[model samples]
Target: MHKPVLTIFYQFNPWYSTIGGIQTLINTFIKYAPNEFEVRLVGTGSDRTQKVGKWQEAELAGREISFFPLFTLENDNFRSLIPTTLKYAAALVGHSFASDFMHFHRLEPSLAALNWQGEKTLFIHNDIQTQIKAAGDKNAILWRRFPAAYFALESLLVRQFSQVFSCNTDSAQLYRQRYPSMGDRVKYIKNSFDNEIFYPLSRTEREAQRHELAKRLGLSEETRFILFAGRLHPQKDPILLVRAIAALNEPHTHLLIAGDGELAADIRTEIAQLGLSNRVTMLGALPIEDLAQLHRISNVFVLSSAYEGLPLVVLEALASGTPVVTTRCGETPKLLATDNGVVCEVRSPECLADSLQQIILHPENYPSTSCVRAAQPYAARTVMRDVYSGMFTRWEKRTLSIAS
Candidate 1:
């Protein structure tokens, strides 16, 4: 029997250079999806050296994936991407490969799926309008300038797909309300963490890891370390977090930053200006294993992003038995509804500082075991895999029926 073909359309960079929550989700599916179906991941390349319309192929975990990258761009500013978008859409439609169903990972790429006879699914990563508004003024102005273009890509494409997958309850609610007629097509599938890679460590193991991290950072055993492990960008609001660290001003309160981006210099300058060079250590884009170890050792994981769909790092932190302090962004409230962590106001240094202080002062109030338990439901891959498999099976059956 021939396996059904499932094509996924989106912009992906296997290099991990342009990382985000959506890329993380796409990577997870690529890593874990069973071999019952033939998968084709169609996307743009992250490597700038790759020529326009170039097709690259590779095998991952014995599964082959064809990567078709668009023409190289000098930078990632989406404002100048209308030409790239048209080119990608043309390439996708012109491709000869036949698929039973197409899974689109973003609104921009859904343009390729238009008028395709095969069933199509939309994966809602984040609210495009929310993201546009969250972007700083200059970028926001581009969207306002091209309101019709944004509407056509975001609103119209959302309705074009036959099925939609919302990564969190917040996104699920947004789609259901925005497209009431497509209510049944919208489904919620929470993002998950791999159990083998992230889990709670024993007390002795945790202590040993903590000691090593402390020694490396020149921190004392009594020091309370707070970790921030996402990109350092305007939307991520790392500056707001750095300001919060300054406001806290406790000698024993140490901040461990575990990622890098365009704002690295600004963050370093802020730390120096605040006289926090001794207290703040920026690790700068650590390997996954090291990041997981840091999560295991840290007192609290903090995410101060302006918005998110459902951050996988938060789940990883919880899986490592570390509590999280995040802004009220995306599905954070639902994820933390069980009192697994604290949610503070967005873009407010004072509120964030106070929230972190509460956790720092009364660590016992949030037990490590509760955090671990709260993340257990999302750790296993069975549910997520089943959802994808079911969708593929249904689409495959529908295609066969149409042929008969």
Candidate 2:
């Protein structure tokens, strides 16, 4: 009964405040792993107090949470991170923990872990090159420049991984085409949402709660709120969300956002310059519970990101029975199969606005539940079981091969 030690490495605060879907997926897995397996999640970066290599161990929902110090000097031209990267690398190299399987959430840590030889799984969540290839405008050009170092690092990481999980197949194939020798190692594992937590409530109850909450917050009944929740980063294209909402401001539709990011202030300014302050409201960052309630009350969920791995938030919205209208960025098409929502051009406010208008004008035409039940396979526990079954089968053979 020797259960293998599984070490998971990712970049997140690992707190309730982190609002990305990747964080949701990892946290869900941490909250549901079997009793026999020892799951250790090592992450860097949160508050500014912890410096490089300073790690603290804590418990979360019966899982081991290891916090590591991470620092970086970011600028418009380049990000100086070698010092912290090497320091974190040294700490990992210094540890001799017997991990039967090592899973890395982000490419940076996965690349660092790849420096040493072991059975490893790396998730190439998105492909920048493919995104660049998918690009049709000037912003995509900016991604090419700002993400060169990151792409080079991911290339190095992919070379050392035993298995690869890509959020989409096109990106996976693009990366694999680079390494002709490493065949069948790359596969697509789409994102899933927690249906149990995000789903339809009673119509009467939802209406009453929505009415009461709106009154409590001093929101008007005419505020037909559309929501877009994610970090305020370039990838998310929150500005586009603002522009879309602004373009559709007819004194009846309002856009309420519930997330924080580096570009929070800039997005606010865009709302003002576009004369949209009255229509757009930023709730900053709220807890996941509050986020779900907001989703419940929303008419539609829109994701304006320029790119994504697999946008789990879209799935969560669909699961909640709130139809979605997001851009065709990243793996959104893969994540949402049901005709429950609409997809528009990435960064095109006009396209987004038009889609929103259609949904808003014909709200009764859309079904509340569509293809949500089809997402059961993407659950963390469900996906993890498939991973474990495949990995253990290989491990036993490898061990037996060595024994023989």
- What's the TM-score of each model vs. the native? 0.88, 0.85
Report lDDT per candidate: 0.75, 0.68
lDDT tens readout by residue for model 2, 33-132: 6655666666655555545456567666567655553432222111123333344455556554336778776555554454555588877666667566
Question: RMSD in angstroms, all models?
Answer: 3.1, 4.0
In the range 143-200, model 1's lDDT, one tens digit per residue, is: 5457678876677677777789877676787788988999999999877887767888
Candidate 1 weakest ten by summed lDDT: 72-81
> In TM-score terms, which candidate is top?
1
Q: What is the lDDT, from 0 to 100, of the residue 368 in candidate 2? A: 67
Instruction: Score candidate 1 by lDDT.
Output: 0.75
Candidate 1 has which clashing residue pairs, if any?
none
